[model samples]
Target: MPGRRTTTVEFVRGSVRGGRRRARSWLPSMFTLANMMCGFFAILVAFRGEYRLACALIALSVVFDIADGAVARLVGAVSPFGLQFDSLADLVSFGLAPSLLVFALFSDGRDSLDALGWIACFLWVACAAIRLARFNTTIDPTADKRYFTGLPSPGAAGVVLASVFAFADLMEGRDRLWMLLVVLVPGLLMVSNVRYRSFRSLVSPKSGKPYGLVVTVVVVLVGLATVPTVTCCVVAYSYLVSPLVVPVLTPLGRLVPDRLKEVLS
Candidate 1:
């Protein structure tokens, strides 16, 4: 009887542990689902002509996207399923949502997008899909994980969001024709050979105190609080052109403080 009771207790403990593991695994997926829902709602809102709200929803989706990956890594729940799910969620949020938002902007109250507008918006979706697909198929363990081969979808979407927010009146008027470049430039960059820094290390340094990171975050928050439109435009446009600017600025890197360099590198 004692032996049977001990075996039963061990089995119960194993089951309990297994149940907890399963629950933890679901946590990341919950965030991914939230991301997808945000994209879906963004699309709906865009159709209703709520440009700012749609852009905000897409931004919220980016937060959920980051959270899902961070949570999955924290729980050691990374899996093939999670990877595929993340890409799909990214397609909806960063690809389709932004494309629809731009299309809505160009079309306004018209029946449909013009030929150039259609092409520009479609290019964004196509390049975003290609970027995600290439990323999944070309995962290389030996390659530099700190840099992406092409512009990230979220970054491309950021360009669109920033343009809309910064040039709200321009995008609404006859001058909106030039806004096509906003979508076209970022869309093309998403498939270009230019490498973009991931900045993951800067945001979450593996070693040393995160004082630089904290300061950067505080500064960004202050900018957002004080001059949100300009701040977003500066950040988005700077990242868009960083591949070109970083090379030119590389020589000046020596002037940067060591602590700041550590956080940036």
Candidate 2:
């Protein structure tokens, strides 16, 4: 009887351990799902004419997207499954959601002008898809982790979200010719050869200075709360132009090999 009790206890312990391992494996996927839900709901809200709320939801999706990657790294659960899932979620959140938001903002869907708006939005979606595919295919473990080959989809989305949120009233009143520039420029940058820095490198598990990063993030969050529109616009546009400015304003360009420089520029 005592022996039977011991065996049962061991079995229970083993079951608990297995359950925990399964939960850990699913953690990143859970976050990715949250990202997808935010994007999906954002699209729904955009169709409902809640543009501000839709923009906010797309912005919230960014937090989930970042968290999923960070959690995967923290738990050492990085897998090809996770990578593919993340990309699909990003397509919804960063690619489709933003494009839909922009279309909803600028189009009434019945005129020649609206037709032009639809084209611009479609171009943005295509660029985002191409950008994400290139990133997945061209990932190099030995390459400089500090930089991305093109503007990230999330960054491109942020540019659109920020601009729309900041100038919502003005854009509603004015001719939306400017919307073409906003959509097209970021779309082009996504597929461009320009190299932009990855903030991930700064707060990576390997980085010894995560505390400084945490403090900086807290400060930025506070700024976001106080002046959400201005802060978002500044951060989004600064990231967009950083690649061009970094090379000219700093000596980093000189460090690039001749072959790499051609591609980066």
Candidate 3:
């Protein structure tokens, strides 16, 4: 009787452990769902003519998208399920939502440029899909996660969002040609091989350099606060042009030590 009781207790404990593991696996998916929900809401709000608020929701979706991965890693919940789910959420949040924002922004133009704007937005969605598919199929476990092979969906969406926010009022009366360029350039870059800094290595918790991390984050936040439009534009455009600058600065880069160059880059 005593042996049977002990056996039953052990069985219950094992069952509970299994339950906890399953729960952890679903945790990241919840964040992914949150991301999708934000994107969906952004679309709804955009339909109601709340463009600024809709863009803000898309930005919020970006936060949820980031948190899902971070939580998955922290909880040892990384799985193929989480990866696929994240990609799908990204499609809606980064791909569809931004395209909707673009359409909403230019829908009233009623000109050839507006038609061009719509085409550009459609191209962005296609590129985003291609980018995600390529990323999933070619994910190299040993590859440098410090730099993405091309512009990420979130970053591309961010450029759109920041542009909308910065020039929401001015965009109406301005030449829509530049608007076409804004929508098209980031889309093209998504499908290109331009390397963008990932900033993942900078915030690695295992780095044992929290002071530097905190300082870097504070500096960025301060910059964002001061002249946000210029700061956002500079940051986004810098990533776009960084690859070009690398070759031009090769001579100066040669003067820096290899280790320092790696860190700076």
Candidate 4:
């Protein structure tokens, strides 16, 4: 009887631990689902002509995308399922949603784009898909963690969001041709070999004090609060051109103090 009771207790404990693990695994998926929902609604709103709100939804999806990865890493729940799910969610949020936004913004009341515009928008989706696939298939444990092989989908979509917020009127009227550049340039960069710095370290630093990070975040928040449109525009476009600019600035990097570089890196 005593032996049977001890076995039963151990089994019960194992079951309880398994249940907790299962629950934790699902938490990251919850955030991914939220990200997908935001993209879905962004599409719906974009069609309804709520351009700003649609952009806002896409921005929110970016937040959820970041959160899901961070949460998955935090809980040790990173899995193949999560990786595939994240790419799918990214397709909806960063690829299709932004492409549709471009189409909607440039379309006349006919709910369609000219051939050039249509191709430009479609290019964004195609390149984003290719970028994600390349990332998955080329994963290397020994590869440098600090750089992504190409422009990330989120960064590509950010260019669209920033353009809409900063220059909606100009894009809608006299400078409408510029919108094609906005979509096309980033879309092409998505498939290029140009490396973009990954923010993983900034988001989840493995070492050192977080005070510099705190101050940086506070400054960014203040900029967003004070001049959101300009701030977003500058940040997004700067990143878009960073591949070109970074090479030129590489030599200058040594002039910066090590501590500041650590925080910014």
Candidate 5:
């Protein structure tokens, strides 16, 4: 026993061992619960007048929500319980939470509380419910995992949240009208057939010339950290318009492709 490690005889403490076993068993549920907690915390923040912080929580919730599913899939732990729990959490985080944020935008409106703005804010929830319902019903084995059928509801909510932060100062007196436009526009887009390219597939491909990408990422990070609200709005609005713009331009632009199309046609 001189230099060699000697194993010590230890008695099993059954209660302590069982407690740890139970805790480890509950890891996935803990993550799922955390997803729900994010939604609740976002609501609490919104009610407490922390609009930006509330929006940020919902955005984080979206990421956590995605991970919960991915984790379940990877671990082969998918269950009806988790699915229902996720849907409920999403309904609050992506639907109701953002709606309240939009409502706050009109709280300081010059005119009467904007009725249209209120409607637009809730529209996301309605559209989200519809989208989720459809998703549950249609289980396509052959569907492309790359692209979603319609714009995801979280993106819809993000557009509204981003607009709020982006134009925070501008929204002082114009809150009513601003919320009306931002909410309704993104809400309509969410239910539309317009297909937005999903960035989910962009994760794996590493560019050979990494320097350009690194610089691009650094510039973006700096811009975001410098003026988050404004940058978020610009980015969200750009994403909203892209799906609508690209399709329209593609067809018309295809009519004349600098003579190349003529030769091909």
Candidate 6:
């Protein structure tokens, strides 16, 4: 220790990192940044033909996204600025970015949907803006977590990304009409009023009995890692169908408990 020497560069680097830690205490900001970063990388990944990785990053961003709000509350750092930043990042990550990735991957530059398809991308951004705006305006004292008034925009983006990846190789030589159906359907779904499960609620409610849930989540993570492409397709498709399943079967209706009604109402 007596012979130890200190350098200005190391001290400066430490100071900068310390500053970042304090700044990152605002949790939602960190999550929002991650979402933007994911979208940024997604564009590059698609261009590089590493589509599976791109989709995975987008999915990972969704997880980070769900955490941002919760983290904001936990850290007592809720702010209008963070909220706006989240919306902007989401529009990039889940709205415009996914849309561009789809066209880039699946389209002929000369098709009619070339014009129409680009416009459809805006539906995602517009609907997401509306959804977030509605959420901010409609706050209730009740702790209700059941259904979404409409399909969540980010979930819709996930389905779109999943579809592209699921049938990545299979898409070649598929009927043009079929591709059209795939592109348009998910765009419509983003703006539809269908109930979707919100895992965000479980965070607080299950905070008490954390161990069992933690183990279960760990297992699920293992399953996801084992087969990324196939697993995402299955999960996203299952979610896309749940809205239809929810309406047709009373049993499906039962899946969304009464508390969820507050949300839809």
Best candidate, TM-score: 1
Worst 10 residues of 2 by lDDT: 202-211
Please provide, for model 6 over 1-265, each residue's C-alpha lDDT reduced to its tens digit, 9 standing for 90 to 100. 4334456667888999888766766657988899889988987887676777777788877888888978887776778788788878887788766766776665543565565556655565676667666655665658356566566767777887787777765655334335445556666665566567665653455445465456656766776789767777776777778767756786676678676543433
Please report the candidate that would top lDDT against the real structure.
Answer: 4
Candidate 2: where is the Cα deviation over 4 Å?
1-8, 172-174, 205-207, 210-215, 251-265
Q: Which run of 10 residues does model 6 get worst, by summed lDDT? A: 172-181
Stronger candidate by lDDT (1 vs 6): 1
Instruction: Encode model 4's per-residue lDDT on 1-265: one tens digit a residue.
Output: 9999999999999999999999999999999999999999999988888888888999999889989999999999999999999999999999999989877877743433467778999899999999999998999999999899899898889999989877765654535667899999999999999999886866776656677677778877898999998888877888888889989999998999998777655
Please report how far candidate 3 places residue 221 from its true position, in Å: 2.3
TM-scores, all candidates, are 0.93, 0.86, 0.87, 0.92, 0.72, 0.73
> lDDT tens string, model 3, 1-265?
9999999999999999999999999999999999999999998888777888987898889889888888899899999888888999999999999888778778766665666767888898999999999999999989888889888888888888878777766766455456667778888998898887774554564555466567667877898888777777776676667778877887886787877644544
lDDT of each: 0.86, 0.86, 0.82, 0.88, 0.68, 0.69
Off by over 4 Å in 5: 1-29, 109-111, 204-219, 245-265
lDDT of 1 by residue, 1-265 (tens): 9999999999999999999999999999999999999999999998887888888898889879878988998999998999899999999999999988888778774643477788888899999999999999999999987899889998888899888867755655556677788899999999999999885644557756666678878988899999988888888899999989999999998898897777654
Judged by whole-model lDDT over C-alpha atoms, candidate 1 comes out at: 0.86
Q: Candidate 2's error at 166, in angstroms?
A: 1.0
- Kindly report which residue pairs in candidate 6 clash with one another: 146-260
Please give, for residues 128-210, the per-residue lDDT of candidate 2 as tens digits: 99999999999999999888888888889999888888875576434666877889999999999888888577456365435
Provide the global lDDT of candidate 3 against the true structure.
0.82
Q: Itemize residue pairs with steric clashes in candidate 4.
A: none
Candidate 6: C-alpha lDDT: 0.69
Candidate 6 stretches greater than 4 Å from native: 1-25, 108-113, 141-143, 173-179, 202-204, 210-219, 246-265
Candidate rank order under TM-score:
1, 4, 3, 2, 6, 5
